[model samples]
Structures are given as C-alpha cells and as structure tokens.
Target: MPTIYLSPSLQPFNKYLTTGDEQYWMNLIADDMVPLLEQNGITVKRNTPGTTLGQAIRESNAGNYDLHLALHSNAGPVNLAGKLRGPDVYYYPYSSAGKRAAEIIADNLRKIYPDPDLVSTVATTKLAEITKTSAPAVLVEIAYHDNPQDEAWIRNNIPLIAQNLAMSVCEYLGQNCAL
Candidate 1:
C-alpha cells in the first residue's frame, strides 16, 4: 500500500472569516479523508493537533511515506487581506514527484472551486512541510480563509474537498479510486 503523511495546519492563529480556525477545518477534512484513503488501500499517518509544525515535519521525515500532504487555508498579505481568493497547491521546486503531485491536486481542485482558473499549482522552497520532508510533498492551501466567499465555500463543501483531495492522492499513487 502507498503510505502518506497527512499534516493539517498546526497554526491555530489562521482563522476563517466566519467559522472555525484553519486547524479545525483542516482536521475535519482530514477526518473525512482518512476513511476514503483507507478504503482504497492507502496507509495514512496523521499529525496530532498538539504537535508543533517542526515536530510534524520531524515525524513525517522519520516515516517511510510515499507522500507528505499538508492541508492548510491561505491568508492573504496584510494589505491584501480578505481580497484574495482561490486554492494554491504548492510543491518544492526541485522535486519532480512533488511537482507531479501538486499538479494533480491543482487539476482536481479546479473541478470543485467556483472558478477553475483560480486553482493553481505553485513551486516554493519556503514551506518546511514541502522542503524538509523526505517523501514527495505537496501543501495545498484550499482557499483564502480571509475571504468570506472562499471561506464559506470551504465550510459548505468539506466532504467534497476531502473526496477530491483523496482522489488526487490516489491518482498520484497510481491507485484506482472510486467516488
């Protein structure tokens, strides 16, 4: 079975515009992803809510996982707060596997997001989750938490988001995913 290290945001400070914090919503999505992945014969190792971001990275690196998927919500820059919208799936610029996974995730997200063009894949070296892990990694910023419309979309479609993400993982792993 392909194994994945699922790291939801550990940052409790990133609050959604109307509802829960980033950690809360991401964990709920992870909750939904677990069973979907397991049913498809994938092994998932998740980070604990109490763990720090550094610890999450350390633990994920210690495991022999095929992929490291980090779930998070975007927050715009101070000047652009509440103005930005969309999902940005990020991968380490140097990793081909990471880029492939990010692309697959971005493509799948386009199907559910309001504007298909808004969903994109980004290459970055700044995020620890993507840079420090041994396995191929992709960090998905589901949507802009500061934007009410985006926030509401995420809140209303948690299960759909989870399903889409799980399917993306299956695609990357070359596993057949139903639903």
Candidate 2:
C-alpha cells in the first residue's frame, strides 16, 4: 500500500475570521481524510496535534512514506490580511514528484473552491515540511483563514475538502478512490 505522512497545521494562534483556529480546522480535515485513505488501501501516519513543525518533518523523514501532505489554511502578508483568498498548493521547486503532487492537489481543490482560477500550485524552497522530508511532499494552503468568506467556506465544507484531498492523494498514488 502507498503510505502517507499527514501533517495538519500546528498553528493554533492563526485564527480564522469566522470561527476556529487554523490547527482546529486543519485537524478536523485530517481526521476526516484518514479513514478515506485507509478505505482505499493507503497507509496513513499522522503528526500529533502538538507536534512542532520540525518534529513533524523529523518524524516523516524517519518513515518510509510515499508522500508527506501538510494541511493548512493560509494567511496573507500583514498588509493583505483578510483580503487575500483562495488555496495555494506548494511543492519544493527541485522535485518533479512534488510538483506533480502539488498540481494534482490544486486541480482537485479547484473543483470545490468558489473560484477555480484562484487555486494555484506554487513552487518554493522556503517551507521546512516540503524541503526537509524524505517523501515527496505537498503543503496545501486550503484557503485564507484571515478572509471571512474563505473561512466560512472551509468551516462549512470540512468533509468535502477532506474527501477531495484524499481523492487527489489517491490519484497521485495511482490508487482507486471510489468515494
């Protein structure tokens, strides 16, 4: 079975404009994703809620995982806070596998997000989770937590978001995702 290391955001202080913190909602989505992945014959290992980002990367590196998927809601730069919207799926610029995974994730997210055009795949080397992991990695910024509309959308569609993400992972792994 293809294995994944699931790292939900640990940023409890990054509060959503409408309801909960980034950590709370990201964990809820990750919680929903686990069973769907398992049902599709994928092995899922997850970071603990309180695990620091460094610790999560270390744990994922120690495992023989096919992918490392980090779930998070975004926050724009201070000047653009609460104004920016949409999902940004990120990957290490040098990893083609990471780019493929990120693109697949962004495409899948476009199906559910309000504006399909706003969902994009970004290539970067600054993120620790993507840069330090042994497995091919994609870090999905599901939506802007600082934007009210985006926050509400995520809060209302946790299960749908999780399902879409799980399906995307299955696609990347070449597994059948019936749901």
Candidate 3:
C-alpha cells in the first residue's frame, strides 16, 4: 500500500480568524481524502499531531512514503488581510515529481475554484516545507482565510474541497486497488 502523508495547518491564529474553527475543517479534509485514496487502493498514513506543519513534514521524510501533501489555508499581508482570495497549489521549483503532483492538484482545484487563474507557484529556496522534504511534495493553500468570501466557501464546502483533492491524487498516482 502506498502511504500518503497528510499535513493540515496547525496555526494558532486560524481558529480565532476563521468561521468554523480550524480542526473542524481540517478533519473533514483529512477524513474525506483518506477514504478516497483507500478506495482507489492507496493506504493513507495520516500524520498525528496531525495539524502541525513542522511535525507533518518530519514524518513524511521519516520513512518511504510515496507522496507528501501539505494542506493549508492562505492568509495575506496585514494590510491585505481579509482581501486576498483564491486556491493556490505549490511545488518545489526544481523537482519534476513535485511539479507533476502540483499540476495534478492545480488542475483539480481549477475545476472547483471560481477563480479562472487558479494555478501553482514555485516555492523559493527559503521555504522549509518544500525545501526539506525527501519525497515528491506539494503544499496546497486551498483558499484565502483572510478573505471573507473564501472563508465562507471554506466553511461551507469542506467535503467538496477534500473530494477534489482526493480525486487528483488518485488520478496522478493511477491507484486502482480494489482491496
């Protein structure tokens, strides 16, 4: 069974700022995506201390996992707070596998996000999440938490969001396990 390392945000401020609270949505994502992968014959190793960004990364590299997917919500600069909106996928600029995974996720998000410009960004060298991973990795900022509309969508569409992402992973890996 191929293992997927699921990383959701553990940011302290997210609860205070978002409508539905952090764990509610994060768990919805993790739970929904996990079964979809399992149905497609992929085994998911959900990271515990589950919402911690750094701990998730550490676990993804701790063994022979096939993929590392970091999930998060976006927040803009203080001045642009509650203004920026959209789903943005991210990849390590130099890794081909990372780019492929990112494209798969971006393609899926493009279908669901109202933003026509939904796409992937190449992470800079200083970004620890993308830089330190040993496996193919992409961090998805699913929506802008700071934007009211985006936050509302996030609050309301947790299942759809997870489904879109799960389908992308199944599509990318071509997992067909009937087990």
In candidate 1, which residue pairs get closer than 3 Å at backbone N, Cα or C atoms, i.e. clash?
Answer: none
Cα displacement (angstroms), candidate 1, residue 48, comes to 1.5
The residue-by-residue lDDT of candidate 1 on 100-170, one tens digit each, is: 99999999999999999999899999988999899999999999999999999989999999999999999
Instruction: Score candidate 1 by lDDT.
Output: 0.94
- In terms of lDDT, model 3 sits at 0.75
lDDT of each prediction vs. the true structure? 0.94, 0.94, 0.75
Q: TM-score per candidate, in order?
A: 0.98, 0.98, 0.88
Q: Judged by lDDT against the true structure, how good is candidate 2?
A: 0.94
Off by over 4 Å in 2: none
RMSD of each: 0.7, 0.7, 2.4
Clashing pairs in 3: 82-146
Per-residue alpha-carbon lDDT of model 3 for 1-179, expressed as tens digits?
Answer: 67777776666457525455555566678877888788787878766534466777777788787778877788888899888888777888898888898888988888888784855565555656778888888888888877878888887788898888888887767764332
Error of 3 at 130 (Å): 1.3
Regarding lDDT, does 2 or 3 come out ahead?
2
